[model samples]
Target: MLNKLSLLRNKIDLLDIKLLEILSKRLELVKKIGLIKNQYGLPIYVPEREKYIIDLKKKEAKKKGISPNFIEDIFHRVIKESYYYEKIKKFKKIKPDFTEILIISHDKKISYLFKNMLTITGYNIKYIKEKNLNINNINYLFKNIGMLILDISKNFFEKFIKKLFLLPKNCILIDLSPIKEISIKKILKIYKGPVLGLYYFFDYQKNFLFKESIIYCDGRKKKYYYWFLKQIEIWGLKIEYMSVIEHDQYVFFIESLKYFFTLIYSTFLIKKKISFNKVLTLFKPISYLNIFILKNFFLENPQLYINLITDSKNNIENIKKHLDYINNLSFVIDKKKKIKIINIFNKIKNLLIFNK
Candidate 1:
């Protein structure tokens, strides 16, 4: 009986050894995945993919009569280890055209964000926070600046544009402030250097790792624009270059108009002493996005909306005209008739600037 017990103990020890070896092999496979993800500049932790993996493991565990919760706990540890390995691994360095970037912004938060992002991607960054940047500092500030990011407020933008001539001719200009088309043309006329107008519509607080960025290209400087595109991509920004006119139009309709309408609706609700929170609780099935908008509407600073609405009057009018045209279209019709009428509109649009 003692001899038989010793042999069984030895067999159990061998099984434990085999399990360790299998786990080691699994880690090796995970390392390979990290390498692949790094090559494509992909994020290490993908929430949807992680959910899929956990669900799959749970299903497999049930087939083997194993506790699903037990399998989930094991996978959680494994996934954590994989993330640690990925974090330890350094990313490949990308050699850009220029080494240093100078960020000039009135917003300290934005300046800090740019500094962090640039530092992560292996670039030397200098951040200058000034409500109204003194022209005297241009001498040292412009020196060795590969790219100059102008995130100035609209109130101080015209003055900032006047000072663009002080920048070194070699330094690529990236303008983020909203300016009139005529004003942009007038400024570019004097500044013979490369300039790229950027209209960042997406909220800076929102994650834009996979989202697209709209950039307004100026002066047809292909190489300069490409360099800017590559620089932004290094920080995981997807850039879309469009005409200045188109950029302004989109901003007016999508950003300015939307904010104005939200403000109007929010104001009306407040005046009526309506409890949006209570209404939101009653309509729990409604989308969280709509709820978020309503909740934050009154909390938003009035100055921002005022700036957008007043500054984008021309583009707002253009959008209004487009909407009026759309409203004039006949809506009540048979399915076949509606299809034919829409086809005619599509055909007309192809010949117009608003079409695809």
Candidate 2:
């Protein structure tokens, strides 16, 4: 029996080697395709193509009497790796007509992620921590910098803007502040050069930039900054242009409101004195996703969420209105108005279904 088991294990190892060889050949084809996509300025991630491949594989797996879901899970991971390799081969370095690009950020991880991506694509990139910014270094650094990226905290924005005079008049400035109005306003007041506002929906922890969207607002000269935008596209990011007001409004709803809801839900769970471990065990698939989101929220810096919730007075007012809406529903529940609740739910359900 032991001899038979050993023989089976050897066969499995041989099959694994064959699988690796196949994957290598597949990656070579992916690399060639990536080059063509880059040459034609096409997007790296084609969702319809991915969906078709997954569906095709699942059907084949079913025909072979294998679990379709298991095959799907395997293909998803394989496709993700393919994307990674494709991007690595697809980067066409567009050397900016600048001496160097300087990235200033409070977060080291954020600074380094941009630096690495830019550097690999053959751009000269330098990083300076926000805390280390002083008049002397500002003078020396800005003298040769072709592009200045401000990813610093809002608290330092005013102070940092005061030093923009040191930057060359022709150098392009990019602000990565979440609050576009404030940063753009401050920077425009001080610097008359070409300015651009970018808010990245990036998860630096994962180190994957494929298909990530960046909210960009043109501050000064679009002609000067257009190349920079194209460079980011080549790196597999999607640029979404919006006005300053529109960007801020969308951020309030997308980020602030979502965080507020997560906070309220987590607070409710804590107030009920429920065991989190037990709750996890009892959660259905949807509930499990909710729990995962809640867990991820807490894993980040608490101060970041605090600032997000309190930054805008309008956001606070909106949160109050949300609470009032919830309170009204609670009152209806207390009064056992089942017909009213059902009517409201059905109206909302129909509206959502129609919209979808």
Candidate 3:
């Protein structure tokens, strides 16, 4: 077994060296071609040429017994990174002819954050206030904008939708999910694909990728994170469609509601002026576990505590559900009740594991 393992490692090492040499030669040739293309003032990227190369690579990958999907992803990132470097170097040489995206919002802080993210992701981002954008003549912006990031919470949804109807079918209209109710997803489906709001999350290796353009979330990074992002692009450079209302609805169940419950419990203790010592004395195990979760939320995403509670379309009534249940003790006193509680707890725990 040891001998076989050593032999396999040797084979892998040789393959790695061969791959590096091949890449070095390919890059040298690409640079030579780039020089010629530069002299002739040809485009930095030729989409047709790219398509042809991808087709050829797909055939080769099949012949080599490689997973085409895996090979394609590797090659796609290689090509994208190469071009990204070129774009940065010759930034002035290429400007997207189309407007790409136009953002109109009532909140300047949120607007600035969204625009900055787009700029980093290599887009020409533009913005206008809601009232000014509502004019009839400037509707041309909608015609060419491939994506729209609108703030419809401040009575802007109807007006934007009115103008957005003029845009072409392939042109996408996007809105960041608002904390308030903004149900434009169903309406925009007429001319757009999946919704792209400010927040998207995907598991990447052991870490996570988060984009908080909507509710003012922070940036996250991991090795596998970019791979996850690139995978999402197949569905129109985004993962899923969501309106501001839809976003809030989904987030509430997955995130906001849990945070709210925990925050309220933590806050209630603070307001009533209860000490950590009292909690440890009464419900040692439950109280200790709860505090661990509570402390992380209180300290890390501290802003989240503020944003979620103050959210415009927040289900204050649903939050009341947790509070209503809080005082209802006498849980599982009898042996039969204890058995039922344990069974229910185990089932819920098993369900969590399976879903994850």
TM-score against truth, every candidate: 0.64, 0.81, 0.45
Model 1 lDDT per residue over 54-167, tens place: 999999999999999999999988876766565423443455446578888877544566566567666778887765457555677777777787776665666667677877
1-356, model 3: which lDDT tens digit per residue? 99999999999999999998987777766776655554444445656777787788988999999988888888877775555333322212223454567787765644555565456545777877766653567666766666566654434555556565676554544445435353444444454443433554432121111221123211122221233233223111234545456667777766777787777788898899999776777876756767777767776646545655555445676667656655432444433577767787799999999999
Q: What order do candidates take by TM-score, descending?
A: 2, 1, 3
lDDT tens digits, residue span 1-356, model 2: 99999999999999999999999999899988887876776667777899999999999999999999999999999998888777753367665455799999888665677788788777888888888877445677877788988788767776778888878877999888777867798788889999999887767665668768888999999899898898887777888999998988888888888999999888998999989999888888777878877888999878777777777657789889989999999999999999999999999999999999
Give candidates' CA RMSD values in order. 9.1, 4.1, 12.1
Range of the 10 consecutive residues with the lowest summed lDDT in candidate 1: 206-215
Between the candidate structures 1 and 2, which one is better when assessed by lDDT?
2
Runs of candidate 3 with Cα error greater than 4 angstroms are 1-98, 106-117, 128-143, 151-170, 178-182, 185-198, 202-249, 274-340
Model 1 score (lDDT): 0.68
Q: Count of backbone clashes for each model?
A: 0, 0, 2
Residue 352 lDDT in candidate 1: 92
